[model samples]
Target chain A: MNDVRSINCTQCGAPLELHGGHRTRSLNCAYCGAVMDSHEGYKVVEQFHDTLRPHCPLHIGMQGVLKDVEFTIIGLIQYQTEEGDTWIDLQLYSPTHGYHWLSDEQGHFIFSRRVRDIPKPAHISNFKLKAPVFLGKQRFYLYEQYRAKVQYVEGELTWIAKQGNWLNITEATAPPVCLSYENSVSEEDYYKGHDAHTEKEYYYGEYFFPNDIYQRFSVEKSAQDKPEGIHMAQPYQPGLTAAMGQVGGYFFWVGLLALFVILFMNADEQPRLKYHFNQTELSTPTLIPFKVEDPQKLLEFRISVDRLTNHWVAYEMVVQKEEENVLIVEKEIEFYEGRDSDGYWSEGSREARALFKLPAAGEYSLSVLFDGGSQSTPPPLFVELYEGVVVVRYFLLLMALSLLFYMWKWFHRRSHENRRWEPVTEDEDD
Target chain B: MSTSPYPAYNCAACGGPLTLKFRYTKIITCPHCGAGLFLEDKAVKMRGLESVMADYPSLFSLYENYAYKTQKLTPIGQVRFEYAHGFWDEWWTLMSSGEACWMSVDEGDIAIEQLVTLDKMPFMPDLQVDVEIELLGESLRVTERGSAQCIALKGEIPEVIMIGDNFDYVHLSGAKGRLVTLEVQNGNLFAYEGQWIDPFEVKRL
Candidate 1:
């Protein structure tokens, strides 16, 4: 056997030579008739032997970063390029799905006709000039043309390119300026809205160029350093919380309004729960008929409170006089009670139908208390001792405070959950 | 005429000054030398219709606005950029994601595909793959494995290529070892790649 010479072509899979033939700067493949020329310089590829196959072969999803004249693989490729004198075609999948013909010319691998039908992350495109491009989950066309310059920093791949820029057809065209910082009248203030170094300025909400290129393009930031986007956000829409706040606030005031209305509207016949000392228990056991002169005087005894039960009711004590000490009997009195279906107050007796009789009298204290449990929880009980400029003002202030406390707790819980969830990883299928 | 980059139009076949003609292109045909001299970029431009020439395959993409519009074509070999659209949008309409895209000769047609699924691609065999990642101006051989093989590196990947999620494909090419950078802006594959791929097949490919 004449030793078959065993050399192979890296591009078209043609046989290559081992020695003298490669020295002329241009070499001809015996089989494929391809002319390989070195612009800067060239390397002679060895034969495709079993041992070499283990060292240098192309595979799928194989990612390669640009190295000095050589591509160092970072991932993998799914398909191989049709062999050219100095190029190899491949299909890549990181930024998007597409095909590329990678060529190794002199000390550089040139990529051409690489197609992608997907969005990519924020990065500079190798085929375009320096600009921030958005890569996401959308169908877009991207073109990148770059040469290989191998330099590693802390074991990281880094290469410099002369020129490259790209275009995104479907993107919103422009991004609004984000200026979350402004107005301190110093360097500290300017740094807030401006990244200083990384900050990129744009003319419209549609395009972003380099910060220095503004002389050629239209670029402006707001007078204030408030980071602004195209969409200005509004206060949170009244949701269950907001609506509740409105209702809470409305009824809170309305409830307050209703409380004042009950106190004042019934100025003539305020539901007064007076402690009538029973004549049978007193030494002066005379049955003296009692008449109320003005109902507005009743407001001085009971307090109005709001409860979840959706109605206003009053609670007070009925007492009987015994020499010097007073007896207590707690009872609830709903303002709506004792009223006919037509909502008119019902009369008690024949002689003076609207009149109520008290057997005896003594100084008494009025206390309003809430009735705990039943089909409905009792309305908040408010006991008014003195009805005047001082008492009424103090009562209203108390009600306002209680409403604010409830709202603050609700909002705090909701905001906490929004920040807790972890964002999805990059590898998972979107 | 602009000064030619080369010294003489000599036919590789016969060592003689060949007369340039557009038999179809800027090929130096030696009426005397009888040798073929193909000056790729120059010859194609001289033909004027170089703008109309279909250098690569015309792929019909139902994904973009101009899904199947026809025009000239060029081959952008391979460069990484983010496939910045969603899977469906990028693959079908060129919407959403970013991808590391490159050109591969399929039969006679050139097609663009993302690099994420390339590892399992039926067409890509189990060849040895060596990966180098450039991060923060640093070059490092991050992964070297067989097909379907993966290697974890320590540098931050501003973005990674995924099957369903969009990503970026960095285009690496430049003088010496320094690679130039460019981006795939938007819509119509051939028009986009045309910016980078040389019109002349001889010099570019």
Candidate 2:
């Protein structure tokens, strides 16, 4: 509910216009730069002799359009930091839309409206980059934070805005839109310049592009020369960045899909034959014969050399081509395990396998020729023949390929994001 | 703060007085001659011929200023395409701040749009209209699907303007404020999102 009030400046003796919105406790004289307490019959609370007016294009009663909504400028407040950094805020009010604000700071205009639907963190300081905060269904990321001291004030305002107000302002930008939280760090946060105090908290801000602002309002510039300052939201390549995100997402899912399909296809696998042979069979370094029942597909022979730690067993294996003609193939199996400061580490493998396809599915003979072994303890050797075990090998290769593809896509996206956040966010949120 | 980067110039083709509104605009339709002029690095050339869009005149016309919210906008150029149902026009618009957007007439409705790139679409181009597809945090429906041949083009284009070119596109409708269109052009998929805007709200200047 808005309670209208009227008062005259004590110093300038000019009529001071008061605004609606039940929050005005102080009003500044636009004529003589005199601060007045509107509640106490236009009492001269504070006065400034120096003329330090911020450059503003809109004045009270001037109407402008933003986001296709028509709003009138009703008030203007100037806030300065301890380091002399200052920005001007123009209060915008519409009969149908209530109230919002257009803040011009360092040539960058921020269109802001108080948003109650924002989910704030328990501590306002918890806002930082990579930390996600949600507003409605849209999630916003904290981008920057600042602490400002409100230095001066003027015009009609909703809140009794005074000077020397210590406000902890935290901002998170989602490009085109920025989420800002103004917290009164303490009772001293609202200084009211001299003798007034106003407290407000939650705020939602959006970075209006220069083009959008130019279209929204008739901007009156002091410099009628060249257009210089770039809009805060100007450099963003929305179309390209949006496309990059989409492409990155597509590549990532494609890689994941390929990985899962490969895994599912190899989940069920069975070995054909598993056999054990003792030193008595391999003692005679001669070719010992064996026959396979079926060998249409490629069969792999895994020889497990059951030797001592750090020991190796070397043997020559031969598979007959069904005509009793032996084809010699050499193999060695060794395994070593040891402990160090970094804990136990293992090297080599105790098993070695050879895979090859036979001429046909008919009986194919195979033999093992042991080259080096001690006869004292019968050399224990086990052989396992597997059918269609190449799936696992192919899966490893595909997984690596998919991982590489995703890595490349994400790396490409990272390059774009680096540009998005490239501007050093230092003291930018005035 | 509003200044046209290119000052008032004469249309080379029609020798008519033309003024460019936006800073980044490279093409504009001559108000007097209605000829599309492509501003090049050295000279202005005649762009693709303008093809008629609708039987009745459009409520908005080329080079005319229309108020979209607090900002004043001017329609710069237009591209005409024929779909399965009929023909539609996409008007190139420049905002007061020099930002550009495109407008299309969809089923007797004005759809204000901007080019947006999306990652991918779940369904193919053959997805039926009204099939709900969740994208960009909104539930969008598959709407228009057909090949649109660029039969007529006039005005400024950010890129090269080509007439008679064709592309197959799938349009997805998201609520009243959002429309997603996925178009496949020469094997490259392009996406654009738009909102259905009320023509009554547009103040003709």
Candidate 3:
């Protein structure tokens, strides 16, 4: 009995035992009752069973099981007796197998081997009711007669077909029907669904056969292969507008943003001293009087305000020179906002127009007053220099364009020379 | 999504169709009414309502509540000299809960920020302000509620008065204790001297 016994329901932990009569045998568990079989041993069932079956607790989805099992649901058979007890029959796939009055509930599909989840097919002839339909979590169906064409494009197998007109079919007619296969089905069974069309295309991902349908019409899939000036996709399409649009807008906006950033950075970047030192003063060891290359350019100032009173109090600037013995010719601070007339303040109103040129090219000191204690709050002030930055920028731009033009000329000349170089070809060797 | 099926009124003066500007508070008036015949609640009220609401919509909406109970305002203080003032019973919406409630307001220490029915107004300080809303026979309190404050001004900011990210408005006083309003407008927060500078003007500036 122990040798004849198989483990009971492994999932819910039920014991199974032998049932039926002496003529016909069945496996039934007594402790946690689950009736499994009537036949004594294993038997061959059906074809579709090879691809899909009931899930087994002992074995996982794709693993092999001990028995050959197949079954089909045909119809629901019912009966009623004089005692008023109800009975039913399930028209199964095989004729020899018969099950009787078990319970009031409908019967379930059972397979000896575990069922597997199938992979999705690349193409399908029909969009609706397509496989693999999940009968249960594990059980699935590949369905019946449908057609698809599988061709190798690039490294992947993609399905494609010639337009129906090429097949001599009606203008409105579609191609032959195809079946979508569950992954458990063999590749040969998958190809059987592919109709024999010589003009049909085969694709594996993006790559396709040289004579494929897409290739035959000269369709270019990538942006690098696209020719200049033609119909294009929306700005969002991958190769058509996406690439060029991004490059166009990206460079434009990026250039604009970069310009603003550069201006802001330049504005914020403040022409800081890469290195500041009194070279002549250090060399000669003087207490003061150092020469500066451009005394007009050195304007390093910091503004401080009283936090409590919210007042602009003072501003301090440090100036350096390149040579000694330069006298302080004249120097005065000036301020303005919007334009010169909106509000203007200088060291002295009368001498405001006088140019404060350095006498002998040496370091000098300058300071300014935040308020002369006037009732009218002078508009926000920034130290203004007579020299405009536009001249320097224009000069730099001209210098850069000239350099780029010459560099481009040199690059083209070198490339042309290199291509023109010939190591005697076989025809030329003669 | 609930739709009001009631037929709207037409301006009696101009013969133009009148639409409800506020939810239940109906001050039906024609735009061509030439700024006269102000409708507070259901009654024809005053003349300067157009200018009053220009500076404060929340205040005008709340003031209309008094019209509901006594049918008008009781003449009080300075208002008694110019026009009649009264208090009435009406529902004021608590912006935080989106529910209509009864509240009250008085003549003294009237905080405009506290009286607002909705927090959608663009103002300054941006802190949750205590509102004074006048309701029917009683006053209800809705606290820590108001829209995000956004103000604008012109002139100068001496210290590192950062805007956005953390603070909304910084009240700074310049020379002579002159109050200057500074707020984030467009992107830059400018410093302006007078309260007379309109919010829209500051935005444009």
Candidate 4:
């Protein structure tokens, strides 16, 4: 740039360069500890005996892209408060967009710049913490206020600066956006009762993740630098986890309805196999032959006994598939406990039947035996069987399992939002 | 035959014959080749890209002159300073008394300030913006404070400030057209007091 001046230190004759900015009147020479005047032909204005200083991540003239804008870091200010707190503001510049400030406090960075068009608050006294204010129709809440001091300076600057300049700062935050008010009471003309007080209020904000600054600038210590704390503006993606539950909810119900449909598709009613044996004094049990059909269908048998009094009867049934003897489905059909009290109660039944899901449809023979008391009046025995198939229990179980899975997701997201808003302490709906 | 306050001279950079209409302006740009000169220092420099124009968004041309109240002021050279948001010009105007003042046009807020020489003032280094302080027996609040880089200089100024020089200034505005500017120049304090005016109050000639 034609505006830049290249010269040399008057004393040491070391080559010096003044940044093209028309406002940079003086600068500290890096080669020697001399503060030289840029306008005064590079004359040394002040000399320092010590050359020791702290290290900084950025040097003058470093260029980096932030948030899609390219800027050159032209200056760095190291500020320390009386309470031992320190922060740094890196002055970034673009030929097209002018100057911006990147403030690095501890490990947190706030990128900002001077701006106009900021809406004035209705009243200045209303600027308090948690107070809601509107800027350009966008609402924001006041977050914090403090005072800061500048302890050191380096590189080019647009305005004259001092090593110990201090400012009172107030910030309003709306997440990813913030408003800052910097007030400086100039020591100039103060004693003359002409206290020059200045206030600079502006808004600058953008949310940055932990690795956002590092990756965005391809920083050297980016891998080691970890951003800590929950920024108000950090993006919340609860749907990333909750979305799975929502989809699962839809699929779960659909699967349950499908299972019910499938269970009923194969549902059938089969004829019952019944055989009877009547005898006063039971000797060897007689075998009753019966033909069976489908074996996959659920088999049920219902047996009934007639004319039984105080005596209880027990019976055993065995199914033989032709030459192959199947299972001996033994059951007791006793009618000993009679109904006599206020509520009719029976411990054992007189007739009983057992269901065997036969493996194959073969010629099966059922052997039945009945036993009764010798002294008591025995009942004339008769047996009957009925069969039915239904899947009501299975459908109910499927519905319960699907509902439980989806409920877990909804509850998880609720806890996530609760933890996120815990700091606010109060909210409306969301 | 002329009531003009100053003598005429030739433009230094362009060697164009020049005439002065008011004695207060320190720098004057050549009409022929557009070369601006620092009249008090007699240093003539050409306009760069940064100092492209004297007025922006507003269409006041280089020929515009103004009559502020009973004072006859002529718009001379201008100094351009920029912030992150935008840039404005400090229009240096010479009065009939051969004195210079700065007129600022910001967002239609027009103000003209004359330099103030205060005998005693508070230390400005620690003063913060938005803080209220008593000045001239009136309570005032510091409204804006920052450093501004002088991007370009086209007019004559009373102070010995160079282009690219840094200025730490605090701005304070009060009710009823009251304003104060505190600037740190050469490690010394400088103040300015001014009043706001309407756009039509400054008659164009």
What lDDT score belongs to each candidate, Candidate 1 first?
Answer: 0.27, 0.64, 0.26, 0.61
Task: Give the lowest summed-lDDT range of ten residues in model 3 chain A.
Answer: A150-159
- In angstroms, the error of model 2 at A231 is 6.3
**Which candidate order results from sorting by DockQ in descending order?**
4, 1, 2, 3
Recovered share of real interface contacts in candidate 4: 0.00
- Complex DockQ per candidate: 0.02, 0.01, 0.00, 0.03
> For residue A85, what is the lDDT in candidate 1?
18
Runs in model 2 with CA error above 4 Å? Answer: A1-8, A15-25, A48-51, A82-84, A185-200, A220-420, A423-430, B1-205
**Which one is best on lDDT?**
2
> Per-residue lDDT tens digits of candidate 1, residues B1-205?
3143333454455555533211122333244533323455433112111111122222322111321223222321111112211011111112123222333222222333332311211211221133344422444222212111111111111122222222222333221122222222222111112112211121211
Candidate 4 residues lying further than 4 Å off, grouped into runs, are A1-56, A122-127, A187-196, A222-224, A231-430, B1-205
Candidate 2's DockQ is 0.01
Q: Any idea how many clashes model 4 has?
A: 42
lDDT, residue A22, candidate 3: 17
Docking class of 3: incorrect
RMSD after CA superposition, every candidate: 25.3, 22.0, 37.1, 16.2
Write model 1 residue lDDT over A1-430, tens digit each, in one string.
0111234554577655322111123333333333333211323322111111111133222344321111222211111111211222222222221222332222122333312222243333243312234433322222222222111100001111111111111111211211111111122333353322321111111122222222211224321122121121111234565566555566567668767776785466533343333213222222222233433432234333343232333233333333332333344443232555777464221111011223334343332233333424444333323322123555677567546744753574345322211111111223
lDDT of 2 by residue, B110-148 (tens): 777787766665656456766777787888777567788
Backbone steric clashes in candidate 1, count: 203
Candidate 2 global CA lDDT score: 0.64
* Chain B alone vs. reference chain B, TM-score for every model: 0.17, 0.77, 0.23, 0.78
What is the CAPRI rating of model 4's predicted complex?
A: incorrect
